[model samples]
Target: MAWMSWTLPTAMFFITIAVILISMTAWQIISPCIERRGFLPLATTRGDRLFIGLLSSAFIHLAFVALTDVNIAVATALCAIWMIVLMRWG
Candidate 1:
C-alpha cells in the first residue's frame, strides 16, 4: 500500500512530529504558557516558536538539498537543535 511504503526516515519524521504535537497538547493542558521576550526580537509563545522553527527548518533543508552534498541526517540534526533552542529561548 502507498501508506505502507514509507522509508525509515519518512516514518521517523512523521513520528517525531506526532510526538511533538502530543506533548505540546499535554503541556498546554497541564500548565498554560505565557508569552515572553526571548533572544528573538519579539515576544512569542510556544506555538509561535514552534511555527518559526519549523518554517526555518524547512528552508534549511531545502537549501541543503539544493546547494550542498551534506547528508539529510545532518540537516535533521541541525533542525532538531534549532527547534530546541527556539522552543526554550527564542
Candidate 2:
C-alpha cells in the first residue's frame, strides 16, 4: 500500500477521533441515547454533544494559535478538557 504523508501529531489526532467514534458506536448499541439537560441551553444527546465539542475544539485551537504564543500541547490539552466537560455536562 502507498503511504500518505502525515506527521506524528496528525496521525495521533485521527487515531484519537477514530477511537472515539468506535467507542461511541458501541455505547449507542449497548444503550440507546436519551436526551438530557445540563449546562447547555437545550437538552442534547451524546451525539449532539460530540458535535458541539468538536466544533468548540476547533474554535479553541484556532483562537489559541492565532492569539497567543502558547504551545500546541497546551492548546490540545485545553481542547481535551473542553471535550470532557461537554461530554459530561453540556
Candidate 3:
C-alpha cells in the first residue's frame, strides 16, 4: 500500500526527461568522433543513433533512479555494467 507514491513517479518522469535531453545534446556534440569510429552518430540526418541513445538513456536513468534509492554502491555498479553492455551489444 505504501508503494503508491505519486511524488516519486513524478520526480522520476521529470528527471528522466532532463537526463535524456542532456545526454542527447552531449552525444550530438561528440557525434563526429562517433562517426569516425564507424558507429552511427547522433548528428546523422537519419536519426537512428539519436533515437537509440534517447531510448537507452531513459532506461539507464530509470534503472539508476530505482537502484540508487536502495543502495548507492550497488546503483553505481549497475550503471557501469549497463554502460559496458550497451557499448558492447548496442
TM-score of each: 0.84, 0.88, 0.33
Off by over 4 Å in 1: 1-4
* Superposition-based RMSD of candidate 1 using all C-alpha atoms, in angstroms: 2.2
* Among all candidates shown, the one with the greatest lDDT: 2
- Model 1 lDDT tens row, 19-79: 9889988988899999999999999989889989999999999999999999988998999
List the candidate numbers ranked by TM-score, top first. 2, 1, 3
What overall lDDT goes with each candidate model? 0.91, 0.94, 0.58
lDDT of 3 by residue, 1-90 (tens): 558567986899789768966876787688733432224443333234445645675676677677666654565566657555445444
Q: What is residue 25's positional error in candidate 2, in angstroms? A: 0.5
Clashing pairs in 3: none
Cα lDDT of model 2 by residue, 1-90, tens digit: 998889998899899999999999999999999999999999999999999999989999999899999998899898889999999989
Give the winner by lDDT: 1 or 3: 1
Could you tell me which 10 consecutive residues in candidate 2 have the lowest summed lDDT?
72-81
Candidate 3: residue 2 lDDT (0-100)? 58
